[model samples]
Target: MEHKIKVAVNGYGVIGKRVADAVEAQEDMELVGVSDVTADYRVASAVAKGIPVYASTDEARQQMRAAGYPLVGGLSDLLGKVDVVVDCTPAGIGAANVDLYRSLGVKSVFQGGEKHSLTGHSFVAHANYKSTLGRDTTRVVSCNTTATVRTLTALQDAELLSKARGVLVRRATDPWESDHSGIMNTVVPEGRIPSHQGPDAQSVVPNLDVVTMAAKGAHTQNHLHFWTVELTRAAEAEEVLAALKAMPRIAFVKRSDGVVAVNSTVELMQDLGRPRGDMYEVAIWEDILTVQGNELFWTYTIDNQAIVTPENIDAIRALAGTVEDGAESIRRTDRALGVRADFTATD
Candidate 1:
């Protein structure tokens, strides 16, 4: 294998920590450093882990260190030092930095909310990694998109099914910082954030059709969302579920008990000992393939932010030719770990 890919994680939030850890776990990738704008407890934690930490300035770094993590310089110095920079900042600000990364000739993988199409491709590590790599930049789909894309990719490729419909009800780890934000004890309608999942999928593999809906809920951890799909073949549900249950990247697939549907994903995360206020556990209910002459409905749970970053790193590896394509990575990683993304559903 090639020398470990040097990776820099740019944002030190929940997703950044997970991404940094995931990078360290990889035999072929190295965590060169971690950076963020503000010095927070998360940054301190990264430093405690022995990863070099840098902020915007020595003074700023000292302030951040007081908050918790030791620091080095500012973001510019950190950016110049790594090969791939995973920008995990919140939506609005991340896009500008992503653009700067591209201009600097450093390949970048961005969190989904930026809603900016800065790169030539969007990636789903297990599904479309090969299609998105080596393109200067790539966007990991939103959490909901990551979950749905994983399922749809398998279905589209395995069963030749087409068309998907989903209703996504989201629970956040914390509320948005806007006073006008409909968070905290409020079930508000934020609608779907503009995303290119449908179009991106079509771009990657034509003849696939999908429609999606989104809602927001109040919580303070990673997002939990659901998807209902319409399949071209109902009888194929069993095979589809079996396939998903066998993928490694997927953490949990619901079991086929009448009382427990895929809706049990959140509870499953709790069982997995996911950190409080974070997304780590996932569950899916392979609901009976309600066949309306071939349309099938099923639901799945996702730890949104967490899903994207690991897969984004995987994408970077593929682009760097450090790993095989997405499908092969799934198969290989499954072999190494002895599990696949698990799937469970009731008939």
Candidate 2:
């Protein structure tokens, strides 16, 4: 029998709670502790779930007091208790903590953000599962990046496109407690947030270079992205649609009799019925793809935590040699979740 790998999650907000829950659900991973500099309902919720709550630092204590959490020591103490630390703090903080986690000899995973890049390698689970071998740190691409890569990898493998260009129109989540949801009636640019999706996915599937544009909005929920691509060959739009529609994690739904719009994709996520506050329930729609015109358009959602945690767990499993490859680890995880992926079956 294999001993379960102990795991700790620092920062118990939206992504942190989800990571902790994901760890608890895995049979090979155990949740050791939950830490936060500024505790709030999330920390209290973790306490309700029977997870240990540590004493925060003085600065953190004051924030916790305001947030209604009984503060704990600074983040350093969370270092010694687990093998992998998933840092879901604000962007700048995670990069700063990377050294601290390394000093403690613990493997860690990072979500994509501007200020930090703690990973030695990145794991897409589908495209680069093999990359996680013996890596001490890993980075899960951003939600937008995840969606784009999945599409780009599929299209490239089918030899449909040689180069890709896309535009992302993203939705902001409800602010930390703002009455006005982020996107009440607004559409904004993602503005140079460097989505490494295009280049990163190109590394695995081969034969494609990608460029992207991003737009952000005030809405606090999921996003609706539009991807316009220039295909290598002029194929029928239906054929291109057929190719994308065939993907497992991706679904192609029609919004109207002949029009593909962002709202159409939003409805798909609505049909998925994922937890209300969960970020992983994004659904995509291939609304407009003009093969004859050498262009394709689509929209999708992103469950940010879903993209990160599984890859992180798989990375640790790869390190432990519990699986021979990333595909096998992903397959094991799918089975655990009552899911089955034909695209990733091992021989």
Candidate 3:
């Protein structure tokens, strides 16, 4: 029998809950428990689902028990029981928890919010999965950086890419926080050249030559990116599309099919019955992809909430040394999560 890797999710917010669920879905992984600092409705939802919940602080333990939510123990208690801890806490908080995880002799995984230097390893399953095997810790690059690496690495693997530039239209905030936070009726630029995403992606695919600029849109839903790439040689649109299609998790949608914008993809995910309407794949507009000699232009949408969930699952397998081949690990994750390479049906 294959050993199921013991896992703990530290943080139960947007990314944390999703990563916890993904871990539970895998046949070769076991979700030991989840730890969070709050006793909010999110924690309640985890309890309702019968997921073991642990408080991260003494105060949180009191607050959770006071609020009638059961607790297993403090964060350290949970960490001691698991082999690896996926720290989904807010950006800086994950960095703060590193010492505790190390003190307990537990492997850890962090989200993109932390610097790559924190773990000295940034992971994108398709790009650098094997490199992370049996490592103590690694940070899964942010959703934008994940998508950037996935797409550009596809081109590079096909031996077609030279360099790339991109513009990201980011959602002002997460959908859940729309009422309390986020900008209204305003589109804000990122205020710098080569937004952090470019360098972040480079951290995973060290040889990638890419630069990015970003702006925050008024609405909160998904992020859209437009890219212009210098290919190694002139390629036809069909060739470029084939390269993208060859990559797993890169799904194609077409304007001709009425999939015209980011909203259309969101609606499509809901119609397809995805949990929380999550589109894990990067949805590229197949009809709009253009090729002019050595230059290629294309666009895609990123589901910030869900895209990295699978990568986190793969990272768990990598860190636990349960899976040796990166491709096999990715295949296992895609199967467990029902990740589809093609969203449309054909005769």
Provide the TM-score for each candidate, comma-separated.
0.81, 0.79, 0.98
On residues 1-347, what C-alpha lDDT tens digit does candidate 3 reach at each position? 79889999999999999999999999999999999999989999999999999999888899899998878898888998999999999998888889989989999999999998899999999999889987899999999999999999999999999999999999999988888999988899999998999999999998999999999998788999999999999999998988998888899998988999889989989888887888889999988999999999999998999999999999998999988999999999989888887777641
Q: Tell me which of candidates 2 and 3 scores higher on lDDT.
A: 3
TM-score ranking, high to low:
3, 1, 2
Q: Which stretches of candidate 2 lie over 4 Å from their true place?
A: 55-77, 114-117, 175-177, 180-186, 190-208, 236-248, 256-273, 277-282, 286-290, 304-309, 319-321, 337-347
Model 3: residues >4 Å from true position, as ranges? none
Regarding lDDT, does 1 or 3 come out ahead? 3
Over 166-203, each residue of candidate 1 has an lDDT whose tens digit, in order, gives: 66667644333334544678776655543345555554
| Residue 136, model 3, lDDT | 95
Give the residue spans of candidate 1 off by over 4 A. 57-59, 65-69, 172-186, 191-206, 219-228, 233-236, 243-248, 255-264, 273-282, 287-289, 331-340, 343-347
Which run of 10 residues does model 3 get worst, by summed lDDT?
Answer: 338-347
Which has the greatest TM-score? 3
Q: For residues 195-250, could you state the per-residue lDDT of candidate 2 as single tens digits? A: 55555555434455787777766555455666667777777777776666554355
What is the lDDT of every predicted structure here? 0.62, 0.62, 0.93
Model 3: lDDT equals: 0.93
- Least lDDT summed over 10 consecutive residues: which range in candidate 2? 338-347
Ranking by lDDT: 3, 1, 2
